[model samples]
Target: MEENAIRNKYQELGVEGFYTQYGADYSNPHEAQIRQLLLQNQDRIDYNKVLDFCCGSGEVSRTLIEAGYGHVFASDPFTYEAYQKNCGRECWQYTFEDVIRTPIPEQFSAVICSFAMHLCPDEQLFPLVYQLFQSTSQLVIITPHKRPELEQLEGVQLAFEDFCLTAKGKQVRLKAYTSTFTY
Candidate 1:
């Protein structure tokens, strides 16, 4: 799906329904690996204001809060009210395009996005990455390390050391990589 198309589809997804469908807490193999990577780099992340870009169901933001992050803003194209209600934090139903159109209210000390970047093609993803780099002091991107992933939402279901394929096609292996930078 194209960026504009994805934006439109998610915009119609109401908060209550979004969670019932794609809530973050759902058992995903990659979840533990992602958490470990974040934990290992705790010193690098800012414990202050954080933004979970494309925070599907607020699971990462919720985890960060529990890990002592002061405040977290969970934003996604689909507004999952269940996450806000159950996670006890603010949730914004904003598309990635919206974030680009309008700057975030407060600068984020640490920005985390998981299983979201792959939704855009490289043409958009690289620029989007640059944009993310500008919005926050630190950034964490968790996506499958494959070309196709740059344009689709299909993520690898991680197991121990490898990410299993979620979509049917030439199976691609995901090697978790955590690239961090401080500005």
Candidate 2:
């Protein structure tokens, strides 16, 4: 889809609605930048166990796996088929709301939410993040927008950040955070 068309669709249906309807076909246009950012900072992630939250099409999982991070799990309420097909692994069907209601059962070294965290509504962000922190010490959010700014949350701290630019000069950022609350 064209950029403007995607934007219009998002405006028309809202983020969750749009994704619920089209997530199986969703593809990140900034995938190259996402790959670049992850490959450049792969060392920062713990390969022990990582959850690719909101793993649309398994972009982050695929990148991390290729980088030799063996224990990569993925979850996306809407993109299970795409994620499984792309990454060749089972994708947990957990939505952000689900996580907020019940934290993930397994602990992870880190949870990577790529391209989709910013879409979370403001009211739900804190609880969702708090729940995520319950499952992992590290939370890595990769976004093209600055809305999430997870560091603003009381217990969350931005430990490191880096960015990669697209051909049109848009900045895609990788923000790694840690919270005072331990799992």
Candidate 3:
């Protein structure tokens, strides 16, 4: 992905403005189907202090809240006012660099990132994943499972055990592995 294009798009429209101008109505049937799928698995995942990284419009954040998760944090570098207004919450404006530089406030029970990690350039891969592991007690990364382009990326294939066996030995467990595809 071209970082400049992404940044420029956000700059031109901001998060909410862009979505309003270009986004499809989630009220459509296909989105309803996706929401049903999400709800089906919502019960299986841990949600304590969940962080929705790169949460563009906080759709999944609202889902987590509706599924009964409390203390959820949503973030993106761009201003997602549409999402914030929809969810009745504010978003933290921070880039992945900022996320890595600052200490994560809580050992999150679940960290959710969808279509977010792939945006990090190749050089930022390891460091970003390391920080991701550090921030979350459980990681639920949702990316295109069949993206051959990303097949060799370590972040996509990283085992939960690898992060669990740290010097701190925080006694982490590989709770689950999940993925999806976009049509």
Candidate 4:
């Protein structure tokens, strides 16, 4: 799909609605940048166990797996088929709201939310992040825009951050945060 069309669709339907309507067919146009960001930050990420939160088409999981990180898990309210087909793994059907309601059962070394954290509504971000921190000490968010600054929230501290630029010179950032809350 052309970039403009995708952007227009997203703008038309809004994030949640766009994903709800076209998630199975969804694909990240910035795969190259995402791959670069993950590869460059591999040393920083804990590979013990990682959750590919909002794992759209398993882009993050695919990159990490190809790099020999075998302990990646995934969850998305939408894109289950694409994720399973691409990553050859089952994806938990959990939305931000779901996580806030009931935290993930398993603990993770790090939870990576690529290209999706910004979609979370402002009102729910804190509760969702609080619940996520209960499941993982580290939360890694990769986004094209700088919204949803996790560090602004209490109990979340920025540990490290890096970025890769697209061909158009847009920045795609990978920011890792550690929970200050005692788990």
Per model, state how many residue pairs clash: 1, 0, 0, 0
**Per-residue lDDT of model 4, residues 1-183, tens digit only:** 677887798899987788889989988989999999988987898967999999999989999888888999999988998898887899998999999999999999999999888888999999999999999988999998988799999989999999989989999999999988875
TM-score of each model, in listed order: 0.62, 0.95, 0.62, 0.95
Point out where model 3 deviates above 4 Å: 1-34, 145-183
Worst 10 residues of 1 by lDDT: 151-160
* Candidate 1 error regions (>4 Å): 1-29, 147-183
Better of 2 and 3 by lDDT: 2
Which pairs of residues clash in candidate 2, taking residues 3 or more apart in a chain or in different chains? none
What tens-digit string does per-residue lDDT give for candidate 1 at 1-183? 433443465667743353345555433345555565566656655658878877765657766877877687888655456567667777777666666666566677767777666565456654465456567655556654454332232222211223334334323233232224333
Arrange candidates, best lDDT first. Answer: 4, 2, 1, 3
Worst 10 residues of 4 by lDDT: 1-10
Evaluated against the true structure, the overall lDDT of model 3 is: 0.56
What overall lDDT goes with each candidate model?
A: 0.57, 0.89, 0.56, 0.90
